[model samples]
Target: MTFGEKLQKLRKEAGLSQEEFADQMGVSRQAVSKWERDSGYPETEKIIRMGRIFHVTLDYLLNEGEGQSEDLAEGKNEEKGMYVSRETADGFLAFRQRKSLRTGLAWGLISGGLCLSIWWTEPGMILYLVLMIVSVVLLFSVKLADNPYRRIEKEPLVFDEQVKADLNAAFSERKKTAYLLRLTGIVLIAAGILICPLITTWVPLVDDIIFAAGLAAAGVGIFLCIYMTGILRAYRLLMRQETE
Candidate 1:
């Protein structure tokens, strides 16, 4: 029999309707329907759990016509637990990466513009302003992209352990840089605060320029800290700590 036929047959022999089976499987009724209709594949984690529920081996579930009738009767049913599909996990990872990239690009453009503006005179400032506007538009466009797994927000996510570990390592390195960026930002802002009043009294024209540059530095620094914290939050979610 096809996997769907087998699934339906097993549910019937167990005296459970589709809705009851869905509850037992920790999935929505619609998700169960989709599975039994052969419209979708469950995440690998769910497939493993299903074998435990039905007293069948992974070979039986994945391969065709491999299990005995007594298998279901011999199985032990565990309490249902939350899960996210592999597709959802992948989509979320992409989303987080895109967000981080957008943030970095935006900050880079703004900082570069401000730094060059201080030395390049009026034309340099104008060019940087144009780049800043373009960056803003790109940021908005990234945010407007459709989310592939909106429903993942409602349930506990089940991501691969290796993927989470990789994310941890990558973000940990980023955290070091984020800390340094924030420190640099604070120093720039403090220097501006100290110099602005004194320079305004003695060199008013350059005071405004230095103060503007300091403000840009501080803003970029704050964003770096915020972005790093956001990455950490996504890492926690991937590790399923959000459920805890």
Candidate 2:
């Protein structure tokens, strides 16, 4: 019995084909097969890695006749160390921070623009309507930035054992909150649009007052939506830091 026989026995006992074992070892299937067939031997480093992957001692992997526990723990610490690396944690933190800053700046710009439009325009109602539409658009932009489509591609493949579950839970909560906020905004905007004709047509003594109050309520709702979005963004950023 030789190293090749030992390698084949470990692979079979672990329920892995040559290709599957090669992938875990980060080597080619042909390389695994060659090792198993006595055509070649893995380098010292790869042999150690194979031992870890198979949960066997180096002695058992090198000598066919040796027996050892297959439940030996090895790769867990390596995986955890990779996940908690400073660089990876820093990258996620930077991404979340930038997103929060961008959302806050967008809200400020929107609020200032609406104020200016109200002051400068002669028909303030029309300007207010335009501002409502613009605010809705900006909210959509914030949502998009928070979960950029490209992030699915760019996110780190490695996940920290301690942080992985927490990150997933936070993400789920944020998504639910965002959906509710968006739904509320959409409903308010639709109601406002339906009331536009009535506000324009009614000629009661208090029609002007009623119209002004409606516009003010709509404005407040829109602003509230923006404020809630900012809060959610900040919460997400803080969660990211906690995970790190």
Q: What are the runs in model 1 whose C-alpha is more than 4 Å off?
A: 4-91, 104-125, 149-151, 159-201, 240-244
lDDT of 2 by residue, 64-112 (tens): 5534444234433333211222233344445554554455445544543
Number of clashes found in candidate 2: 0
**C-alpha positional error of residue 218 in candidate 2 after TM-score superposition, expressed in Å:** 5.1
Residue 83 shift from truth in candidate 1, angstroms = 4.4
Q: What are the runs in model 2 whose C-alpha is more than 4 Å off?
A: 1-156, 200-244
Highest lDDT: which candidate?
1
Task: List clash counts for every candidate, in order.
Answer: 0, 0
Error of 2 at 16 (Å): 36
